[model samples]
Target: MELEEIRVAVLRIEGTNCEDETVKAFRSLGVYAEAVHLKQFYSDMIKDEEQRSLFDFHCIVFPGGFSAGDYVRAGAIFSARVKSVLKRDLEEFIREGYPVLGICNGFQVLAELGALPGFDEDKPLADKPEMALGINESNRFECRPTFLRHENDGKCVFTKKIEKGKIVMFPVAHAEGRVIFPRGREEDYLERLKENDQIVFRYVDERGNYAGYPWNPNGSIYNIAGICNVKGNVFGLMPHPERVFWRYQHPNWLENPESPGDGRAVFESVIEYLRKF
Candidate 1:
């Protein structure tokens, strides 16, 4: 698809706070991107022209924020509502190689939706979530710049433009962002992700070495910051890429006044991947 022909839907619903920035991230790349409310896809109260279908866009994104007030564990409420209304469509979308991304609260949603660590290629979403983003080991929200080392060996289309081992600063803000695998199966899941080349990013300190505490932030097992589905079509992470799409958005904007931000490559990689279709 040509750049203009590519349409991206940055999905949003009540309490989703980053749609505008997410939309700006893609729009800045010259793609047709917009923030579409989840209700706009299925709510009958919406006008005919306002309603949308999952197939209308080339990519789907679930941006960050406390959806539904995060009253129910993080993204639980939003994910449940999405599955109840559009499970099949979402599954088919991922199976078709359309990109689906969830960031931060959105990451929690995909985990709750059972779409990440997608072990079964035939089953895009497991019967139940295989992992969980539990409360931070700190027991409080950790909101600050994080160094992420891109680890995927070219399987993840979303990070292809990013060189392997490259470290980028993307800010993370969440209380329940710790990625925990099934108890007694943590090493097993990590091994599988490594074996399939599914791991996308790992948290590291400024020196590019895996560290704990504030550096690893949430104390996720293996310092995992992100991962993709079995087919590499769906991805989820806890950091906010859209929050640093421009140099001015960076923490050291005055000193690192580069044209594109550290996070720009995340969007660029996907756009580059879509240009072939």
Candidate 2:
């Protein structure tokens, strides 16, 4: 991987931070990625007639943070602003099968934007999304490194390069990290997503068992850490994979030689997906 070969842009807005480490993660992987303030892009679009749109980027990243100070919810205000400004371009980008990833707070935005597990890509954005990442059943924000197992093979261009049952360590820090499908239809929703192979990632014990609270930190339905749109182009996850991108970011890296690159898989997965295009 080299800067000249890979191109990505970290999307940031007022009150939404954490793009710096995200840029470093991609750059470290030899991907020439940079943090682009959403306001700057919006301003450029308004000031320069010849300027290309934000959709020009290969991949767009919505990092984690308190966007709009989590007003109305974790990402409600931010998602609304994005919809108002970049709605058309964003839709076109998704339609073209380009990748868009939202991590933690970003995931909340995507869910609010009707982009994750996106049911109808052709339909206009809805007032309320059918699915949501609700408050954790635990009723507390748990900030700790946890492992997620890749459970499905078909969904998510990001997970296509990862091995089934592969355990990747990442941090989960959110008061509301639970994945909720519409009411009473829990089993049906899980069965449908599973059959479609859309259950992209899930919490799992070291031996791959779906047991223990340490593994299933927030009690997300089916221990889900993430999922993708039907087209596998739009991905969203509650855990902050982007947070642990460096070796030192892991608490026990130096003490454990067997510690493989936990956070690297995510960036690598995105790169591999883009290479196919």
Candidate 3:
């Protein structure tokens, strides 16, 4: 449980505002988390550089917020910057079997960058930015505490320790939280995901009282709140798990610090996964 056991890099860039919470979340698990600004990589002026390679970190996080102001599309600018500057190192990291997580706006970034499935092999079809995260079916930005049910087929490194059908609470805040896959190819993609066990997390009724609409918050395809790559190394999701790292951060659980009901499991899962590497 040493603080220096796990190494995590929390990327910070313009419009990327969730670094502190992400850092704190990992720090609580006694992991070494560093907040690295995107400017550090996008810069060409620093001659004697000591920046660590993406491979050096066991987990790399693209936390929430409207990266690049969500202009020209969410995560477009920052994604392009990453593709241009960190492409080689990032791809190497992926090939090396490390965990990469993109949360909220970060999820949008991964999709736009063709880092997720359906778009991983090539660019998405015309008019689509690899994957589409469009306006919520509700047409409004919903910010509420939510729950996600773990899928059994999901064996991703990030969610490996979470039991099947286990429901965890986290909050999602986004206007374009609805996930869109190719039309008429939904089942095919899902089957492929199932065969590969790629589906990681799904929105569910936290109270276990309802099964649709408000319980889902956003109308994501297949109730998907998050997913992983075929290799189970890269993960991208819409909810802000880092925001609920502590018991007080939870919407409930006021009198129980050891309830084990907050979002700490997400970080601990990463810690556990890193232990093997």
Candidate 4:
């Protein structure tokens, strides 16, 4: 597909407040993008002209924000609605190698939908969640700048433009961002992620060394902050990349006036991948 031909859907529902920024990020890259309400996909309340099908877009992004007010364990409510209404469509979308990205709360939704750490290639969507983005280790909502080290071996479409081992700063804001696997299987799951090169980003300190506490933020397993599915078409991260698309958006912009923001490469890489499909 040509660059201009690629269409992106920044999917959202009630309380998903980050849709606008996500739409802007793609639009800034000169691609066709829109903030698509989930109701348009399966709800009968919307007008016929406003209704939309999932197949119309090349990329789908589950932007950040407390969906359904996070009243029932973060993304549980939103994920259930999607599964109940558009399960087949979502399964087909992933199976067809279309790109899917989830940021912050969206990451929780993917976990709730069993789309991340996608262990079974034959079954694109798991019947139950294999992982969880539980509450922060600090037991409070964390909002601050974080450093991430790219760890994928050029497999994740979202990080192709980023060099391995390079540390980039991306701000994180979430209450339930810690990544955890099934009980007694943490080590086993970590091995699978490393073996498949599914691990995309890991928390790191300013010196580029893996550390603890504030450095690791939510205390994700193995300091992991982001990951991709086995097929590399789906990715989920806890940070808000759309919030820092430009250098000025960085917290230390004045100190590094000439450097391009790290988040831009993420969007550019995905768009570049779609152009080839």
Residue 41 accuracy (lDDT) in model 2: 58
True lDDT of residue 120, candidate 2? 72
Q: Over the full model, what C-alpha lDDT does candidate 1 score relative to the true structure? A: 0.92
Candidate 3 Cα misplacement greater than 4 A, ranges: 1-5, 47-50, 118-129, 207-210
| Model 3: per-residue Cα lDDT at residue 237 | 90
- Location of the lowest summed lDDT over 10 successive residues in candidate 2: 44-53
Task: Say which candidate scores most in lDDT.
Answer: 4
RMSD of each: 0.9, 2.7, 3.0, 0.9
Could you estimate the TM-score for every candidate? Answer: 0.98, 0.90, 0.90, 0.98
Off by over 4 Å in 4: none
Q: For model 4, where is the 10-residue window of minimal lDDT?
A: 116-125
| lDDT by residue (tens digit), candidate 2, 137-230 | 7777888888888886856887776788778788888877788888998898788777777778899887877875867887888888898887
Local distance difference test, each candidate: 0.92, 0.79, 0.78, 0.93
- lDDT of model 2 at residue 233? 82
lDDT of 1 by residue, 1-277 (tens): 9999999998898999999998988998899998999998899999999899999999999999999999879999999999999899998988889999999999999999999899888889898989999999999899999999999999888999999989999999999989999999988999999999999999999999999989999999999999998899889999998888899988789995857898889999999999986
lDDT of 4: 0.93
